[model samples]
Target: SMICMNHLKVGHYINFGLARGLGSIAYATTAFSLGLLVDKINPSLLVLFFVVGMVLLLVDLYTIEEIAINSDAKTDTHISVFKFIKTYRFYFVILLGFGITFGASAMLSTYLINIVKSLGGTTSFYGIAVFAMAASELPFMAITHTLLKHFKSEQLFVVAGIMYLVRNLLICLAPNLPILILGMLSQGASYGLFTATITYYVSDHIDRKHEMMGQTMISMMSTGLGSFMGNVMGGLLQDCFGLSIMLIAGLIMTLIGSLILVVFSLKQLKTHAS
Candidate 1:
């Protein structure tokens, strides 16, 4: 879904934005139709659909120019992940920051419904909050590359942090349904910015020979370690303290992580100038 963004003439962020926005529309349409069709459709036919989809994806993959052009045909006999990490400590540090940021985001996502309910939101309002966040991604993603042209990726990360800060604060203190939903708008500015750009940044900084490995490490950081920690820590904090305090904790972590990235970005700029 993401790697092919590197191949677009329109630019990675723009390509990703269009891809995700259209994907969201298709997903929503498919989900709604699936809901309606589930009762009438035979279970075995669903498996057939899944197999056909996989086959189509495989065929599509073979047609992508980037896959043909960018991939190595020769297999590596002795690839060492640890040696790569040792050599690219700088990239790892930035990835560490990404992990923390994503961890906090996961915390927010994990408990959003509970926070909404605490603010006196009904089931309908909860649905609205979720829908608004998802729906908002389309337009924001459409403009993400435009925003990137005006700001550094790290600067955009800071913007994402600020949005997240606003979101967590509002969720922590919101007294009514509307305010809580308003906080949900930050989803577009936060994840819509960071998630779309992180891969591009990694690709730019890492050597082409190890590009895929670097991306795998990033995936582990953001989704594997970060998500796991977020789920456990978020749940524990919510259980021990409350949703409000858990969000506050997440806010603090996010700020620290963003600051780390900002420092790294500035350092890179300085090094480049010299």
Candidate 2:
């Protein structure tokens, strides 16, 4: 997914947001269908269904252009990934902020079922919560361009970071199922803003030739490394303190990360002023 995003040279934000929303809708629909079929159909058939879906997906992907042509389409000298990292340290800081946002979100996602159970929610409630959280992305993403018109991507990134903090705080303070579900709905703002803007942010900062590596780096942070750390640390926190405490930890992490971006924004503003 990250690799594909770099190749997109059109209205990138719109394309990204629409794709993400559609993908989330597909995911939610699949979950709902599987829930309905769990009792009526054999589990093994689900594997066949997935294979069919993948084959169809491959057929579609075969139509897309591998490399997008742009003004800077000229080939450049290749550098190893290690050298690229050492050369572009600032990108890593931005990625780390996103990592914290995603890490906290991943922690919530990992233990969502348990959290629902703790709140006296049923299995149906769990499925509904997941659907709502994902489906919430649809409307926000559909209007993402409108959002960008009113707010800079950097400001939106800060909004996303703050929403990440807010979502965790809501979860931490949730006294009942309804409040927790509200927190779940907040994923629209938190997740939507981050996913929609991150690619554009990287595109603006990194060279066109290094597009693939740049997107890959962000993906590794948000989805790969961040998720891994969140799962491990969240489990430890849960074990040591409680699930609620883990949410508090998430709140703090998000705040610190968001603050970094806030400071960065301020510095940029001051530089412009000078």
Candidate 3:
């Protein structure tokens, strides 16, 4: 559906805008739902959120109407859920990426509030932190859109690595509100820049027909997989490693991601030129 809009000759701009808007709305809706569940349920906040997430998964599976890619009503009518997924290596890349990014993110997010309180933060401070973190995304997003015109996935990936490292490094050094806020601001760059660049990269690399699936896969990683991991691990790490250790671990993972990107970018360029 997303790719179909991407390839349209006319109405392209309108279609793309609507598709992105709907995606944003879906995200906003989910965030709102989670907030409401936590606020109203209070004592069973965790259970409420778990059930809500499950409900969302059910909706995704059964609610969204799907049309076969190349439907031939007479004979080419057989298809399975896994059919499209089984055919592409890029699909798996997206899945793995989603796993690493999302899982790690969940662990981090889960601990972030607690960690702040441990470091002398108040409830209002947590709210301030969340707002600051979100506010930082806009500038980085604007920067990405501008740079993407001249750079490629490879460069953006490298920069994202550096940003993540910087954020984690700052956390390890200064576990205070201001520095933490700075680290989170760096997170906006890591999240927005990496995602935007990688999506465009996948769109460019994957076969035209599967671009939308690739896009969806990326979204699933950052939101579904990332959120899950961030919450789970975030709590665990806060209990186990403490804030410093979490920062070190996150820094290492991001560094590894950066190195992999660098190697891949060089290889890709050489392959393309030859």
| Top TM-score hit | 2
Better of 2 and 3 by TM-score: 2
Candidate 2 lands at a TM-score of: 0.87
Whole-model lDDT values for every prediction: 0.70, 0.77, 0.58
Mark the regions of model 2 whose C-alpha exceeds 4 Å error after superposition: 1-14, 65-77, 80-90
lDDT of 2 by residue, 126-191 (tens): 999999889988776766656776776667766776777777777767889999988888888888
TM-score ranking, best first? 2, 1, 3
Model 1: lDDT equals 0.70
Q: Which segments of model 1 are wrong by more than 4 Å?
A: 1-6, 9-14, 24-66, 70-79
Model 3 C-alpha lDDT per residue in residues 149-179, reported as the tens digit of each score: 7876666766675665676556545557788
Task: Give the root-mean-square deviation of each candidate in angstroms.
Answer: 4.2, 2.8, 6.3
Model 3's number of clashes is: 12
Ranking by lDDT: 2, 1, 3
| Index of the highest-lDDT prediction | 2
The Cα error of candidate 1 at residue 228, in Å, is 0.7
